[model samples]
Structures are given as C-alpha cells and as structure tokens.
Target: MLARDESDLKRTPLHALHLARGGKMVPFAGYEMPVQYPAGVLKEHLHTRSHAGLFDVSHMGQIALRPKSGKVSDAALALERLVPQDILGVAPGRQRYAQFTNADGGILDDLMVANFGDHLFLVVNAACKAEDEAHLRKHLSDACDIDSLADRALIALQGPKAESALAKICADAPSMKFMDAGPRRVAGFDCFVSRSGYTGEDGFEISVPAEHAEALVTQLLDNPDVLPIGLGARDSLRLEAGLCLYGHDIDTTTTPVEAALEWSVQKSRRKGGARTGGFPGAEKILDQFERGAPRRRVGLKAQGRAPVREGAALFADADTGEAIGKVTSGGFGPSLNAPVAMGYLPTALSGIGTTVFAEVRGQRLPLAVAATPFVPNTYKR
Candidate 1:
C-alpha cells in the first residue's frame, strides 16, 4: 500500500480508527480512504462476498431535503421532476435509486433518496456533492430546506452475512427489507440504518453520528464474521455486479436509456407524456425512448488473461480497424476470476456475442460483447 501524507488527504471521522486497524489509506474522492486493509483488496473482495465486510463510506454526502411548504408531496413532486425514479410513490421508510440528470438527459450523478417519515433523505456521491447540493438548493423552492449532515458518518456492512453481523448489535436488524430504512438505537446511540449497499450483496449502510462512529464500528467489527473492506474491492465488487460507477460507466455524456437504465424511469413519467417531460434534456430522452439511442452500453470480456483497463479503444471489426467505442470501466473481477469490462458501442455492434477488438498499447486484442453481471448478483431481492 502507498502511504501519502495524511495532511494532504482529507480524513473521515474514523480515519484514526482505520490506521489503528492496519488500514492502508489512499486518496479517493479527495479523502484518505482505505483502498485495502492488511488483508489486501483481493481478500477484502472475497470476504465481502462470503462474509460481512465493513466499509467506511463517510465521505458520501448525506443531506435532508424537506419540502418548502413543509408538505412532503411537494418535495416528492419536485424531485420526481428532476429524476427518473418514482419518488412520489416512495412509502415511508423506503428508498429509491435515482439519477441526477442534465438537460441532455445525461446522468450527472446517481443517488439514493429515502422518505423518512416527514422528510426526504439523500445519499449522493462524494465527488459530486458540491454540484448536487447547489443544484438542489437552486432549483428547490424556499419552502424546502436542503441541509447537509456533515456530522454523520456512513458505514456499509455488505455480504450475505450482513444481517447476522448487524443483528449482534441491533435487535431489529433482520426485519428490515431491501431498500428499507429506519432509525435504531445501537449501543445506546441513536443511528439510522438502511438495508442497502453497492456490492450487489445483502447489506446495510449505517449512518452514525461522527462522535459515536468509532464505538459503533468497533462493535460491528468485533463479530467474527465481519472484516474491514476498502475502495479497491468495492470497485471490483460493483464491476462483477454490473453496477456503474458515477464518472466511469455513466457520465454527463451518457443518457440513462443509452446506458440501459431505462428501468430507473418510472411508469408515471412514461405515461404522463408532455406534462412530465419537463426535466433537463427531456425532449432528447423522450425522443430516444420513442425512437432509440444510436449507441448502447454493453459488457465486454477479453479473450486472454491480461486485464484491460479503461481508455482502451474498441474497434468495429477485428480486421477493419475501424474505431467504434471505448472501454469505460474494466478490471479483473474477483468473483468471476476473469477480466471483465463495460463500454458503449454502436447499436449495430452492441449485441451479445458480437466479436470486437480492443487496442491495448498498440496491440489489437480480441474481445466480445458479453452479457453483464459477469458473476450472478446475490442482491437480497
């Protein structure tokens, strides 16, 4: 692990605790997050799949967006106007994944929005928090309050054993369904717990007060089944699960439909027609929906042991050398034990089993458009 000066990188609330546990900190999203522990990224990736792995994701922005007029429905409608998800139908204690879109229907960022009784809670990417918060405040009416919860720390306990591990600390842990959230008392501290994660595993993301983060994390890690994980493994895990990283797979230039995330657009939006199509790039998105995007995101598999990284140019024909697309996210999938990648190619060449070529260091490598989730996702529902 490469160790840089702790002063240069921002630290989460549990930064000291991570160092104490032999965590190797690295710069990620401007924070000194652990990319791996003493066990290494490979082991951490495997541990999170087979057992429970605790991850400190405190850098992620947590914000509360209360309706301007103190009316929850108004806030939901306002948010639904911007995102593709059905936020208006979100029942109390339930959360929905949504995308922040630009005028062109390109994704600005992906976030989780939860309806917490009277208020709405949002979990946004750490890297895009500033832009996201500013956008939310500027667009929302004064009746709504957009407040950041910087005093809180976020932690994810991911894997099939997440419930058992968390149950050791909180009694009602097992009853929570996927995407369900609630406030709970753990070790005499009030914390908000959600049954959700990014690794495509059954898990929970716990939001604890910064002052209490250390003790709460300690209690969870004390369980024999729980190990500490880091960002490197988190990337590999999401890759195997076919989930997109904000700046990688999905970006400002990639529309949700082109990225094959049309499911994120709720049925109401599709049915409302012109009335609901008031969001940024709505015309283009609706047109794409009516017609179709010229290019589509697809998964790729290298035909050799060498792992392909992002920026590899994709070719239209193996022998023609015609450039068609480029690799977005690529890595050695720990779960699949092979090299897997994702990229966007011309619609005609995006079919499954289509042979493609990738230019790696001037060497033409054979590739193929394969079905994603290279490894079957084990998400709990």
Candidate 2:
C-alpha cells in the first residue's frame, strides 16, 4: 500500500538528504519517501542507465538471523521451514531470492537472503516487514534468533559505472560478483556491500549503520558519476528490468509457479527430492510443476501509446467481450521508448506472440504477450 499523509509518515535516515536535494516527497509504505527530484523521472531514469545513481532504500526491512547453537547451517535450515527455498544450500557470502508462501500456494512476500558466514541477512519489502518478522519468529525461533536491523540504512549504487564508482570508495567492492555479499570498510565505515541491485545493472546494495549513512551517501554522491535517484525512477528502472514489485506482480493470492518464478525454488525443495513437502504449499507448488496453473504471469507490450495500468482487465482481441486475465504492473519503458507491461493470461492465450486487449479508459487497446526484460539486463556475474 502507498503512504498518503506526511503528517503521520515515518522518515528514513536519508530523509533529510533527499529533502536537501529538492526531492518531491510522497507517502510510500508508511514512510515519507522521495518519488522524484527536480531533474524529473525521465532524466533520472536515463541518467542511471548511463552513469551511476545512488538510491536510498532504508525504508526496506533488514533482518539478522543468529543461531543459538552457533551453527550457520542450523539457522539456514530453520528458515527453510517457512519458505519454499533451499536456504541451507546457500554458500557463505552468497545470496538467493526467495518468497514466503501461504498454504494455498500463494506468496506472502519476496526477499533476498544472504549467508554471512556466521549469520543470515535478509532484505524484505518495506510494507511486509512486520508480518515477515512475526512469521519468522513463529516458526524459526526454536533454531535461531531473529531480530530486525533497525539501526541500519541501505543505499544502492547502480548503472554502467557502478563498479568503478564503488571501487573508488571501497577497494573490495568491485571484486564481488552477482549476489555476493560481505563486510567491507568503505571510507573508514564498516558496511556490508552486496554486489546486487534492482535495476538489472551491475551494481551494489550497501548496508551501513544509521550513524554512518549520511557520510557514506555524501561520499558516493561526490564521485561525479553518482547522482541521487528517487522512487519514480526506481520503479521505471525496475519495470524495464522486468523485475517484480511485491504487491503488484506477486501477493498472497499468487504462487511462485504462477508468477513464473519456479527457478528460484531449487530442485531440493521440489517433490521426490530431499525435504520435499516440508515448506508451506509444497504439494500445491510441486503439483503446479507437473500440471501448470490455469493462469500465468507474462510480459506484455502495448501496441498503442496509452499505458495499460495495474488492475486493467485483459481480453482476447478477437473475442472482444470475455475477459481472459488482468494487468498486474504496467507503464512506459523509458529505455524501450515504448509502453511496456506485465500481466496474467490463461495458458491458452499466454503464448509469446498471442494477441490480447487492454480495456483502458473504455478503449480496448491491443497488447502482445512478449518475453520479459522489456530492456536487456546488464547485471555483472
């Protein structure tokens, strides 16, 4: 849900930095977040593609998982009980994307988990933090200690010059590959830098203590290559990257398989494998693998100028009357120079070249089911 009123909205550690830079603030996920700056969304989106861009994502939930028995694998295994992921298999310093699923095979939230040698670190959506913390404590308390990292702030440096820009401040940052994470001393501040980002670019997500956030952000922004970006550009960049926004692309009523994220669930968690049927909705999820879901998420390219926004109903172009599916996330791809979107359609009409219609403002606009990544992903491996 979007934040609406600033009077009661919470503020992040970087809230002042955004305001100082003339950010147009908006309520988002219970916080006064920056949706855009004076440069505007279009320029901000393009700047991040050409140069490095810094984003303040401190509103997200950061969690630390510690095992009482002092065993890393034990903590990892405990996490596997709630989500349909092979958390125990995550190697030290590596991370994986996972989702907390419901008994009906629906997703509660999606997150990233990193193995930090002695403990596990998780980054979850801002709106789902409380629920996620409760879920972890309810099921994993016996094996591990769960706590929120409320004293930290996170920033992302993204785009083509991300590595070089980061390397200038932190010598070890450039060495990390995709999904790799560990501690590093950057500008004399102890921080956790993960070579991962949301823009489908080669970049890093840095986690630093709250006290050091401002200094770190100031240092990165001084690099000339890095400009401060806001939420509007963040959404557009992620959309072009074809990444899923939790509430829009996935939710409690959507399963991982239905959302086309089966790859994130390793083979070990599937039926006939070790620890099968152990997680929430294991049976339903595995069954969907053999017998696919009736409706599936797919990428859509609008044939007209109007954007097919979320909740817009999809219909068969030829049938004209019966609705087949609905758009979950839709917008104009600044990089693609055209309108791009993602939606769910029945398998019969979900083929890559299938034609469909979006009922936007009473006009049934034509849309085509196309492969995702409306813009090519350039993540460094």
Candidate 3:
C-alpha cells in the first residue's frame, strides 16, 4: 500500500470534502490525499507557520490495546517489553513517542503511544500498521486484546495560533498540555484529542469516528485561522522540524543508535544491562551505546538553489566521490526559504562543520553537515 503506481489509491473519509475544496489529490502511502488545497502548498505552509491549519491524517492507523484483567498498568508493562520506550511511565491522558523495532535493531516504525484512560491508544504509520498489529498480537499475552480503529478519522490542527483557534471549538481545550490526551466533544462528536504533533509546533490531533469526520473538520475550518493543509506541506514542515520519515530516514537498515534517536530510548531501558536488552538486536544496540555507531544521520544544507531530492549521493570528501551515504529526504524548506535535507554519513564526516558534496543532476554540489531544524520549532515546551 505504498505510493507507487497510483491506479488504485485508497480514499480517506474526507476524500470528497478534499476534492470539493480543490485539493490536488495524489497517492501517498496508498491513500489519495490532498497534497495541497486551493490555497497552494506554499501558502498553506506559511499559513500553518503563522496560523492554524487543519490536516486530514485519517490515513494513519489508530489502534487500542486493553488488558483483559482491566489493569491498564499491566498492559503498558507488556508493551514495554516489546519497545525500548518507557511506556509504563506514561500517565493517563498523556502520550509517549515510541518505535517498533525488528530483531536486528532496525526500526520497523516510529509511533505515538498514549495512555487513554483504561486503554492504551496508539497512532501508527498507515504503511506499517498491519505489521505492527501482527507484531503486537504475537508478542502480547492472550490477556491483552488488540483492536484497530480503522473506522476512525484523525486530523491535526497545528501552528502558532492552533490553540486559540481550536479553543473556540472545544470548551475543554485549554486544560490539555503538550503530550496530553483527553476525550472531548468536537463539532458535536465525541473525540479523542492529543496535544502532540509532528510539525514541531504547539498543536492537537483530534480523532473522531469516520462518519462524523467531515463535519468536524468543516466546523474547525469555519475559523479564519484554520485552513486545510495537505501532504506536500506536511512533509516540508516535518523535515524543517528535523523529524524523520518512516521508511526513508529510519528503516530496517538503520538502528535507533545510528539514526541519532538515542534520546527516544528511555534512561530506564538503558539500565540493568541485559534486562533492557530483550528487544531486537539488543546486543548490537548496547554495543553502539558503549561505543558510538559507525555512521550517523545528520542534517545537510546544499549551497545552491537546486534541491537535491532523496537518493542523492553523499561523499566522504568533495573530490573523492567515494560514497559515504545517501540523502534520505530532501526538498525546499518553505520556512527556511532554502534547500534543506537530512541523511547519514560516516561518524568522521558527520561533524557540524564537516563539508561534503551531494551529487545533484550529474554535478557535485557543495554541502555542509549542519544543525537540523533549519527553522526553530515553536513547540509548547
């Protein structure tokens, strides 16, 4: 269900509404999503930077896990055994960022895990949800029940003005803080709202029943600051925020250590030696922690206007042309107003001021390994 030949793309619950709003529909992760609305990608990007923008992320997978004994703590512990993140510490109405790993220590997918009252709520990548569910079912005990929220729709309202705009729609909005989750009525529909987002901004992700999604989105859009955004802008925004995409930036080939995501590995998971080593490739991951990884992901800034897309060859030295790594993601950053990218390179060549070359259109362009988040993120703490 990847974005390949799009002869048959899956439509989301708001597909018709997107078309009505003049969204340029495109195939992404098997879903026919709007890449931009009538406002255009650039406008939508800037608007989201300064105002609130509504995004239809229903294509993402939403799932719930419950303990058969009605003990939520036990369910979280069972999940902690699978992933490196400290799920057991997640408070009710709070969310934690986590990843699913393979036996080789490679990341299968990075996801959000929320303690939604008596049940655990998860929002996983649409492309990897099926595999994630299978893994959870295989690893979890029989007392845990896994349920997919396929009939649910998810939307993100992000940017500086997101809170103020969304507050007008839900009376209980102000009480929620970063990474918090709570149930509330949105547009007359019972919904789960989370104060976390991928765009590196203060935002909320609202999950509602599929049948009531369109109306909920329409009601939010009624506010002047809330505009409909699409996948194109979302990609640029996340990249600018120094976030990684699932298959490209982090994948089965790259471990969390090499991906520069050691922060996501909780401190408790790193303690007790082998006790925290049950996950995939635990030995290798532990070794990398003791000694740094060989290659590491870093941010790249090209010197020219020509943006180097993914797959651009990265070199160890400018004239050597010897491949050190490859660009995982690259594009024009609307916020930074320049070409920005992220990729991996040998540890020696990954320093902040290290110079490299990116092969773009048969010519090597000057590139420097620079600090990420080309633009500062305005996340609410």
Deviation in Å, model 1, residue 240 alpha carbon: 0.5
> Model-by-model lDDT, in order?
0.87, 0.91, 0.88
Model 1, 1-381: lDDT tens digits are 222665667789999989998988778877998888899989999999999899999999999989867778778888876787778888989888889889988999999999887889999999899889999988875557899999999999999899998888898888888999868876678888889998988999999999999999999888989999989999999888888999989999999989988877877676464345767777788788879899999999999977888999899766675789999999898878889999999988899999888888888788889987787766555
Candidate 2 lDDT for residue 254: 90
Model 2 / residue 171 / CA error / Å: 0.4
Can you list the residue pairs that collide in candidate 1? 68-143, 68-144, 103-281
- For residues 54-130, what per-residue lDDT tens digits would candidate 3 score against the true structure? 89999899989999889998888888767888888899989999888877888999999999879899999988888
Candidate with more favorable, higher TM-score: 2 or 3 = 2
Cα shift from native, residue 70, model 2 (Å) = 0.5
Instruction: For each of the candidates, give the backbone clash count.
Output: 3, 0, 0
- How far is 135's C-alpha from truth in model 2 (Å)? 0.7
Quote the positional error of residue 95 for candidate 1 in Å: 0.7
Q: Put the candidates in lDDT order, highest first.
A: 2, 3, 1
* Cα error of candidate 2 at position 190, Å: 1.1
Which parts of model 1 are misplaced by more than 4 Å?
A: 1-8, 271-275
Quote the positional error of residue 39 for candidate 2 in Å.
Answer: 0.8
- The candidate 3 region of ten consecutive residues with least summed lDDT is 271-280
User: Best lDDT goes to which candidate?
Assistant: 2
Candidate 3 segments whose C-alpha is farther than 4 A from its true place? 1-7, 273-275
